[model samples]
Target: MKLKLIAPYLTLIFAFLIISCSSDSSNETPVDPKAANNKSLGTAARDFLSAEAFTGLHVEIAYVNGFKPSATTINNLRNFFSARLNKPDGITITETVVPATTVGSLSREEYVKIEKDNRTVFNAGDELAVWIFFADQNSESDEGNSRILGTAYLNTSCIIFEKTLKDFSNRIGGANLTLLESITTQHEFGHLFGLVNLGTAMVTPHEDEQPDDAGVDKLNKHCNQEDCLMYFQTVGNAVGGVMNSLPTFDEFCLADLQANGGK
Candidate 1:
């Protein structure tokens, strides 16, 4: 199947900046009521993606023309997350059309500048910005690999391929594009919101010559285990290439939010 050919999702890379010297209380300002609530971890053993009231997370999706993503793509992604998350305030998804833009050979500086310049459509911590670059998602030789289908370190946002949003028959279709896009956003945003891995070092699969241990299988979710967004093969759990069909929340993610006072 075409879905199987799509490489499984990879963990996001986060380079945290430590502000060594600062007595600024505002910098450590308490999280907003909504964020505080999202950080709350309930004891219910129900799905991590429990239905709840809308928290009003506004998502702004921007596309660099030549990549050609559809208008309905963003909507599909929003609906998927909405069904799983209880954010009653209502989440808003908006599409920003940037004409005369080419996705070819887009650089980090170009992307970072575009994001900073479009502050009217985006807010640093509150908004989820989706940028679709004109690149091949399946290309392993991409020098700027981080520019597509992954999280950006400059501002902590999501970027994907325009090909991912196509309706090609006999190929990956439906919500698969949106699902992959959202997966990148969800995982990266999890880190920005204070979710840390249980271990200090980022987990890698079988770096040594030892046999692969079933216990170290980070792709599969198991009972009495921590299913974090940083899982090595998080995308493998989903059906087809559609990430919405997979489980969105787990104890580890919930607990991380709670520890950071997101609930």
Candidate 2:
């Protein structure tokens, strides 16, 4: 009888532990919706472009007329951004190439022109105009390969990417540039929406030592730990040594989005 009673007690204890573990697991943080949203955006935008909704967005492509990039290069750049953003089918994105000689290094007047162009490109609809520039005039080394630039605004109807033929040429026949374009454009757009930073604004000397370079690609961030995308990891090199795959922002970026009600 005593043995039988002990057996029942053991079973009850086991069941209670299982319930407790399940409760703890369920209490963990929720997952991000972007992975799903990105897939959906891609499909929806592609379908929209294929259907009758194409011309209404008034998307037009124009180069500075004397710009260095061939028409085809400009087209390639536009297509890349459109596909990445999952642009709606009815909307049109115009790619305009500004001549390096005409708008060499963004000037005050040039900036004003670009800003006005931005308003025109985006219009009241989802229309966009992408402008490319080679060098900012403020930088010393053009070979630091930093020409990849653009801005995406929230209230505005357009986006801009300033690139030079030389910078474009260097990225030819590689996925890095493509990845960089998509990541930068998407990230900037997120910023226009008032998304806050995630994680530490800067990497600490200690965390810098933890980068995947020494084959420690995985990091064990504790609960309550926050990382912001603006954080710069100064110590360790990127996992693939490619800036595209590097964390332009930390994983906590996604987390912050979730906390702030971003889809």
Candidate 3:
């Protein structure tokens, strides 16, 4: 009878060990496929930007009529990007400028139509294309004053805008046109990089709390830090200051880029 009792206890102990092992195996953490893919893509993008010597990325610029940016302005823009993007090794920037033509004043709808047409020629690939229109852009609702400076289509890797830099130069006396142009370009590109609360994940809370007229609940798609290039307040206004001093990507902005596969 004692032996029989001991045998049943041993069987129970063996069954308990088997169940424990099964539970442990089932609880092992599973790998996330989406996260793995995103990480891989981010790594690849960084590698492409950091290459020692290669074709690198291409930026095609098209200007309309008398709004062509000067050589000095172009060089300044290139230098700015080279320092931030290439770092030590330095990457190549291939710029192709299209000559001016007669593109008169355009409304918001007309501008979008033109942009859509340009997309066919520019072809959304690895290259970045920018179209600079000479005419002013007026809001669809308010057609009195020129509002928008620059706009970037993240999906197409394209930027479209008018000569708002010149407008700012006129409004804000003693402002450098070239520098303003450079800042405008930088700000638009910042949007493409997913600054503030855009596609790129923010390392810190730099998003502005101010609500735009559109009645959007969340923060504006700009940095809260007034000095950041991504700040919306700096775009068209000359009250605080002018774009003679080009804006830069602040620490918080840089941190977001670093996290999102940028140099």
> Can you tell me which runs of candidate 2 are displaced by over 4 Å?
1-92, 96-103, 117-119, 122-161, 164-175, 197-240, 243-251, 258-261
Deviating ranges (above 4 Å) for candidate 3: 1-55, 86-104, 107-109, 112-142, 156-160, 171-174, 214-217, 236-243
lDDT of each residue in 1-263, candidate 2, tens digit only: 00000001223232110000000111112112212111211122222222222223344444444333344444554554444233453345555554343445543344435434432243233332222232233211122322223332212212233243223324423234434334333343333322222122212322222234367643322111223222221101111123434233345544433343222
TM-score of each: 0.49, 0.38, 0.63
Q: What is the alpha-carbon lDDT for the whole of candidate 3? A: 0.46
Q: Sort by lDDT, best first: what order?
A: 3, 1, 2
In order of TM-score, best first, we have 3, 1, 2
Candidate 1 stretches with Cα past 4 Å from truth are: 1-56, 65-89, 122-148, 154-156, 164-175, 197-228, 236-244
Question: Highest lDDT, which number?
Answer: 3
User: Positional deviation of 14 in candidate 2, in angstroms?
Assistant: 58
Q: lDDT per prediction?
A: 0.36, 0.30, 0.46
Clashes of 3: 0
Q: Give the alpha carbon lDDT tens digit for every residue of 1-263 in model 1.
A: 00111332334642221100101111122222222221221111121222232234555666655453444545555665565444455567666655443454444445444544442343235333223333333222233322123432322233443443332212543346545545544543443332333211122231112113344523121112324444434433332333454345465555544443344
